[model samples]
Target: MDFTAILGAWIAVGLTLFILSFLYRDNPLFKIAENLYIGIAIGYIFSITIYNVWIPKIYQPVSNRVFTSLSNWVPWVSKFVTPAGDAGSLTPLFPAIIGISLLTRIFPKISWISRYGFAFIVGYGAGLAIPATVATMFIAQIEGTIQPVFKLASGGAIDLSGPALWTSFSAILLCLGVIVTLFYFFFSLEHGKISKKVTKIGIYFLMVYFGAAFGTTVMGRFALLYGRFFDLYTYRTSGYYHATPILILLVLIFFFVYFGKSRKTSP
Candidate 1:
């Protein structure tokens, strides 16, 4: 394999080992890995924002279009007397201006200037989130819960109407159960006799639902762990010296560090 590909594979193995450390116990090694991951992610986001948002949306558009346009000349003069269009076509000055405005919060003299950008960002984010929550999340969940349970026949010979009715009735009950259960936690007032009874029934259904969800989550995690173990076993069988030795060493190191930390912390 090429050096780059080999390096990438090694990094992937290291990351997997770091994540597996959590199965043993929390320690300095896991904390370092987690913090490094967060730092790298933040740096990546900053780089992307500089390239995508600052350059294309704010800088380029403002420098190329807004400067040369005759309509903006009067307002531009009134705002600031500095000559426009002197900077290059893709000048970084506009981004610098906005960045300065954003940094105003660090200085007491111009803290109020940062509020403009913050308000714009907050308003736009809220506007986008509301529609997405309603259309994608809320409606999709309702559709999933209310879906027909029966399978259709190819020849159109058999009637599936009864199964559909049963499915609808079950869905209605499930919806009511969830709603009542949610309402049970909504208030401090003492629940009346009927409310108490309904809430008690709701709790039973909720517990069943939660138990199923927990089972599914556990199964998914176990499946991932099994896959990793399978990879290690397969590599060993194939006589891959690097993968087998590294996997063994990683497990041993993780266990040692985890147990060492646990011993130190335990009373």
Candidate 2:
């Protein structure tokens, strides 16, 4: 492999071993990996926010509002998307001003200016979220609960004969679960004898949900582990790759460092 590729592989192996060392104990290696991950994540997010959200939407349109000219050296996309007039430039000023105001927090005296930006962000976010949340969390969920559950037959007829029975049963269970869960959350109804039994059933459903979610998360993490091993094996056989050896070396190095640090810091 080229020097850069080999170096990257070594770094990746070191970082992975450092992160995995936490399974034994949290040590300097793990802390270093954790901080590095956080730093990289923040930088990645900031770059994406600037490129994806700020540049095209806030900067380009405002900077050059000229109409699209497809035949120009620039891509034809500019004609349709570029703002029509000076209004395009003016459009970005308000949000840009608010965004700049947010930076005032760095200066204690002018930090109050940041509140305006915060308030604007909060108000806009709430305004946007309310309708989206209602539609997605409430209306869509209710619609899903009541969704029809029959299949079409070979003749394009509703197949109520066989599979529909199972489908209908599952739908009925979902609807009942939703109803019972809602009732469980309804504080107005006193938890009397019958209500207690019903709420118990609701709790059972919730437990099953929580268990399934936890299992799925565990499986997802395992999948990531599988991916790392797959990379190690796949690339190791590629002749140019040395990830597996590097990984083993890092594992040894991390364990030694971690043990030495532990002994040094031990009371």
Candidate 3:
């Protein structure tokens, strides 16, 4: 590979080793890698937000508004103004004002101004999200749980030996799970012997759900670890000039020398 490509490969290998070193112990190498990753991620996200959101929605619309106004007085400026179809009018500037108000929190005396911006954001977000949440999480879930039972009952005759039996069984189990889980959260009524048993079933269902979710999350993290390991293995080849082996050797030597010196210097 070219020199630049080889250099990039070496840097990637070194950084990967630095991050992996954390499994042994937290040290300067791991901290350096962690901070570098965070800084780069923030810089990338900021650039993306600026280009994708701020420029298109805020800057362009506001600039077009100013240009359109100026063009009325100077005919030559009309050429700089974008088409009316793309101009979002001055509506975008209202949010831009609220966004700027958020920055006022940096000042001590005027920090209270930021509350208005925060209130608008919270109110607007809730207004948009609450209906969607209820529709999807509450209503849709109820519909899904009930729809299957309705279909199973409406079918002329029950077939215990066919897929219909399996479908009906699953639908009944799901309905029972939903009812018991909801009852488990119903604190108004005192839970008696029968109620306790129902709630115990709910507890089992919840535990299974939470365990499955946690397992899926762990598997995703391991997948990322595997990918990084694969890259580390690839860099061991001659095409990357054995960057992985050289870095690993350097890391081992550094650990031994540093710890050895520390032991001698200790009281």
Candidate 4:
């Protein structure tokens, strides 16, 4: 293997092990790993903002359209170049300025300037968000709750026909759960024994719902771990992937054991 790839792989694997060391105990090694991870993430975001966002959306447009329009009024440049097609508005500049103005918050005295940026962002974001939120979360949810898979509007009767009649069963259970859960939150009426019983049913449903969500999250993490382990396993047979990482891992382990500060001592 080449030196560069070996060095890179060793660094990656060493860092991985350093992070994994936290499973045993949180030590200086883990702190170093955690900080490095955060720094890399921030650096990555900056690179993306500069290259992908600012360059394409802000710089290129202003340079091509705004500057070109100005340059065309110049005597020699007017003959040499064509102005970009009129985009009809300079709205992009406002957003670019607001984004830049957000940086003023980093300074103590000029931090007040950032509030305009925050206000514009919040107002604009809410303008975009409210309609979508209403449509999806409010209206659509209510529609889903009321619109029955088991009822026929034309006949004005419940259609109890489907595969094993489970559709009707599910619809009935859903309506009951919704009603009972609503009652659980109804503090206007004192929760006597009967109300307490109904609320208990709601609690059971909530537990089941939360359990499913937790299980799904665990499954997702496990799936990702499996994928990474699969790649590691496949690469193990190849020589380039193995020796460097192993050597680096051993060195790191010895260094941490011998020289690093720690509250916990190893057996």
Candidate 5:
């Protein structure tokens, strides 16, 4: 492989070791790695927004219209210039101004100005999201729950096969789960003895749902951990100049030296 490829492998291995050091204890290496991760992520997101959103949506439209001469001078700029056939209005400038206003939050004295930007964002986001959420979640969920009942009703004869029986049982269980879960959240009326029993069933359904969700999340995390470890193992080979092993040794030496000095200095 190329020298740059090897260098990149070494850097990756070193950073991975630095992050893994947190498992032993919270140390300078871990903090350095953590901050680097966050900083890199923010920088990457900003770059993506500038390229994908800012340049395409805002900058290109304004520049193409206002600076038509530059488009002739720079051949590549001509490609991004909005065509005459398309509507090249400067309407996008409003949102651009709102986005800039949000930066005022960084200055304590002028932070109040950021509220306008925030208000627009919140209002627009909620207006867009609420209807979509209701359509996809509430309506879709109700439709799905009652779908099996409709299927059974439409059928002339009852289903007696093993698969059909299983489906029927599942539909009944799902409906029961939904009803009890809704009742569990209904706090207006006092919970009579019967209501308490129904709510207890809801609790069981909720616990099962939460446990499954947690398990899926844990599995996802483990998959990431496995990928990192696999990369580290691959880097330990001679092809990568034993990047993982060398970095591991360096990290171990640094921890011992730094912590040893600190312990010796302390009373």
Candidate 6:
């Protein structure tokens, strides 16, 4: 019931309507809102870059050392002092130097120097990813697929006379299907007739798997769209100022369509 709160609620309703205007058609109002959103996002990113990364990691460390040296306040200079000279309380410069080298990519003339930075980053990323991919996707998946289908009791024995045999056989078949389907894509050597037949079966399984994955992705996209529609509907229905921006957008779209039709009829 607060006046400020009521004003804020109305503003939210107007903004929601503006966003929904996109569904009707591309209008000046929607374009303005879209541009404002992009500008705000860019401003946020710039602020976050300075606060989170640049200031803390680079500026503060170097600035602190410089200030301490100028102040002539060597409280514990012995820790950082080396055999060559009193280097003062300063962090290692190698990381900063590498970071600077990465920034050189912004310049057209010295962009080649950034290749070392790219190589280092790529090499490190690949080194980590290769082992992780092998362990998780390859080894762990293989282990999961080939696990014992039988239920083991606390007495260190499995129920052998149950449905374990059938389950185990199915598991083995599934594992083989996945492996063979993956190998079917590799065309280094010519496959014989029997091998070709097996690979064709593998291809069918692979197709089914890929189709299911695509279907799932499509469902996920639809779900996201549905959620956005729900949000628009709920906000409008809450009596927060019923601005059916989508209706306006639809009107605009129909107007354009009719105008185009009229032009075509004249020709």
Pick by TM-score: 2 or 4, better one: 4
Candidate 5, residue 197: how far the Cα is off, in Å: 1.0
The TM-scores of all predictions, comma-separated, are 0.61, 0.75, 0.85, 0.78, 0.85, 0.69
Give the per-residue lDDT of model 3 (tens digit) for 1-267.
Answer: 799989998989999999999898777788999999999999999999999999888888777777777777888877765545454478898888899999999998999999999999999999999999999999998999984552333466545566777787889989988898888998999999999999999998888889999999999999999999999999999999899999999999987887778789999
Q: What TM-score does prediction 1 earn?
A: 0.61
How do the residues 1-267 of candidate 2 rate in per-residue lDDT, one tens digit apiece? 577877676677777778877888878878999999999999999999999989878877765543433324477766466554443454777899999999999999999999999999999999999999999999998999996766777999888775687888898899999988887898986799999999999999999999999999999999999987776666564453667676677677868876988799999
Best by lDDT: 5
lDDT of 5 at 36: 97
lDDT against true structure, model 3: 0.87
lDDT of 4 by residue, 1-267 (tens): 777876665566567667766776666777888999999999999999899998777766776675566665665775665545543245678888998899998999999999999999999999999999999998987777764556563568655566526866776788788888888888997999988999999988888889999999999999987875554454344555584456546856765775554425544
Better of 2 and 3 by TM-score: 3
Q: For model 1, what is the alpha-carbon lDDT of residue 131?
A: 92
lDDT of each: 0.70, 0.80, 0.87, 0.74, 0.88, 0.71
> Where is the poorest 10-residue window by lDDT in model 5?
147-156
lDDT assessment of candidate 4:
0.74
Ten consecutive residues with minimal summed lDDT in candidate 4? 258-267
Clashing pairs in 3: none
Model 5 score (lDDT): 0.88
* Model 5 regions lying over 4 Å from their true place: 69-89, 106-116, 149-155
lDDT of 1: 0.70
Q: How many steric overlaps are in each model, in order? A: 0, 1, 0, 0, 0, 2
lDDT of 4 at 64: 68
